[model samples]
Target: MRGDSWTESYLRSDIMRESVIYQAILEEGELSAKLTSIPRLLVLGLTREQIAQALDLEIEQVPQVIEGQN
Candidate 1:
């Protein structure tokens, strides 16, 4: 997905990852990450809650944004 920037790059970007992490952990997970405030999609100072809010979801319903490298 990361290789082909046109096909799946949009779905596997850092911003997208953050959104997924924020939403998945928020609703499905046990809130173990403790994401409080919102996040910056620019990767400057993004938080768990920020990603969730950006994705139009609750802090407790955000997904887990795993680093593509790791």
Candidate 2:
């Protein structure tokens, strides 16, 4: 009975950890998409500050993001 309880606890902990990692992965993907779209938004008449605000990024980070895309 004790071993079964330990196994269950371990499984739950592992599942929780995996869930956190999965969330991080999804956030990274969303950020990547945002970064890629910055240039397109700029070409479409959005100013750098506006793009940064819309994407929830720092205005200073905009150039770096564009550089990375290039």
Candidate 3:
């Protein structure tokens, strides 16, 4: 197959989604999004414990995320 066709086939949404690299990227993006939301949740009156539980993050990780945002 030509390079363009091969690349296109490999990058198709369904095929890309099945790749281990793609899955890892997706998970990282999800975790980033969750971490990014922590400060907002705090401003809305959620404690570190509540945010950790609601976001399914470790309690220790909550403070770390907050610190990183500073």
Query: Which of the predicted structures, 2 or 3, would earn the higher lDDT when compared with the native?
Result: 2
TM-score for each candidate, following the candidate numbering:
0.27, 0.86, 0.72
Could you give candidate 2's per-residue lDDT for residues 1-70 as a string of tens digits?
9999999999999999999999999999999898888999989999889999999988988898777777
Which candidate leads in lDDT? Answer: 2
Question: Per-residue alpha-carbon lDDT of model 1 for 1-70, expressed as tens digits?
Answer: 5567665666668678899889987775544333332223525666656677665656564443333223
Span of ten consecutive residues with least summed lDDT in model 3: 13-22
Instruction: Name the better of 1 and 3 by lDDT.
Output: 3
What is the TM-score of candidate 2? 0.86
Clashes of 1: 21
**Candidate with better TM-score, 2 vs 3:** 2
lDDT of 3 at 9: 78
Q: Tell me the deviation in Å of residue 24 in model 1.
A: 19
* Residue 20 Cα positional deviation in candidate 2, in Å, after optimal superposition: 1.7
